[model samples]
Target: PGKDKGKDMILLTKMDKRPPNWTFVFAVDVARSGSVSADYSVAIGIAYNSISQEKQICYFWRSKGLKISEQAEEIAEISKNFNHPYLLVEQNNMGQDMIDELTDKYNVNVEAITTGAHTTGKNIKKEELIRFLISAFEHEKITIPRGDEYSREQMSILEDELTKFCAIPTPAGNELFQGVGAHDDCVIALALANRATQTVGIPFAVTLGPGRTQAGGVYSALLQATRGESDIEKMIKLGIIK
Candidate 1:
């Protein structure tokens, strides 16, 4: 139900549900709506084990001409469909307005990515975002599925953007990254999703540590089940991993 206008769309990987130890993160890059020539607002969903392994892109959506409230409602609906993922919305331009709508109207918990220098929380600069995405790709830590036409088209856009993405040196010695003849909407959304994988703010997921708490012990056991460590395979069968 993500389609609205002819250009607005959503795509999914059609994969089975993830294990309990896996965590889902969605990142959004907002753009001006109501104009075909305007930048497309994009959201990317990534699933990772929150321990060791690559992050998989399971969802892709882009749309234009949607109002701020409409965008927030779409995001909230997607979150519910994906088990209430840890969501990060870029806090720039219409992003702040969308964040407010999502939080207040939809009751969706969200974290804002400060686009500049900040003393608290996740403050991600543009350069950092690009570099983080590059690092993930370089380390082979990101998997983009191309199982279907929609997935293939999105991957092609990602490849095209990365190919034409250029860095221009500013007068102040900083570099600005943008596409030469393309939009960086998908690239920015991907970078934000990669950044989300590094954040440790998932309220429901249990982090590994030496602890005797019931939740911690259960999670540890579930992790062992994934490794075939012992008889702890029952943890997975019990559907307690997620």
Candidate 2:
């Protein structure tokens, strides 16, 4: 089912124009019952690409579990068409199983980026990521692929969820959707992936032996601080401090 070369070519062209070094993280969900008529056996797919100057361009897609095979094929096709080097995936709940199935069956190369020991908590990290995503969306930095009605609807739902996902008075009042089971894991995963991509920088270079490495700018410095990779002393040493 991969005959749509025209559209794929357009996307691939755009991908090529992006930074040569970039990370594409995709988070996908599949239904447990494998039911077709259910509320989408497959939930959503978040594609995040790291760009230069510590920016990440994100794309969100939604589909049914029954169509995951085709959707994954398209995603893989896009990755291969554009020559993306990495695919960072979030391994939580059924995420790992679905990704594993893709790897084993479709031969898609994906890696799991572990969430380090959280000093604050996973929830806090999730919230921070959400905030960043919201800002990115507001600034029109994130793009949703066209012609996908499901993804369009999910984006609307996400907008509503964000509106209600602010600090409140009661302990449970602050929860999105009154603490219902509508977990924002997909959104949170996307945000974390974007953050990770930004920390490493697009076109990330691995210095075998450090001589004269061109460090990223302020945004990278801030992201490094958030990831606990830099301190005041290091910033000063890097010539970022006065």
Judging by TM-score against the true structure, name the best candidate. Answer: 1
Error of 2 at 1 (Å): 40
lDDT of 2 by residue, 125-156 (tens): 33344444543443334443323454345555
lDDT of 1 by residue, 161-230 (tens): 6656655667986656666765888888988887787774332223232211123354444544554222
Runs in model 2 deviating more than 4 A are 1-16, 19-25, 29-33, 37-58, 67-75, 113-125, 131-161, 167-186, 199-242
Q: What lDDT score is found at residue 155 in candidate 2? A: 50
Clashes of each: 3, 2
- Candidate lDDT (C-alpha), each: 0.67, 0.42
Query: Lowest-scoring 10 consecutive residues by lDDT in candidate 1?
Result: 1-10
Error of 2 at 57 (Å): 4.2
How high is the lDDT of residue 150 in model 2? 48
Least accurate 10 contiguous residues by lDDT in model 2: 5-14
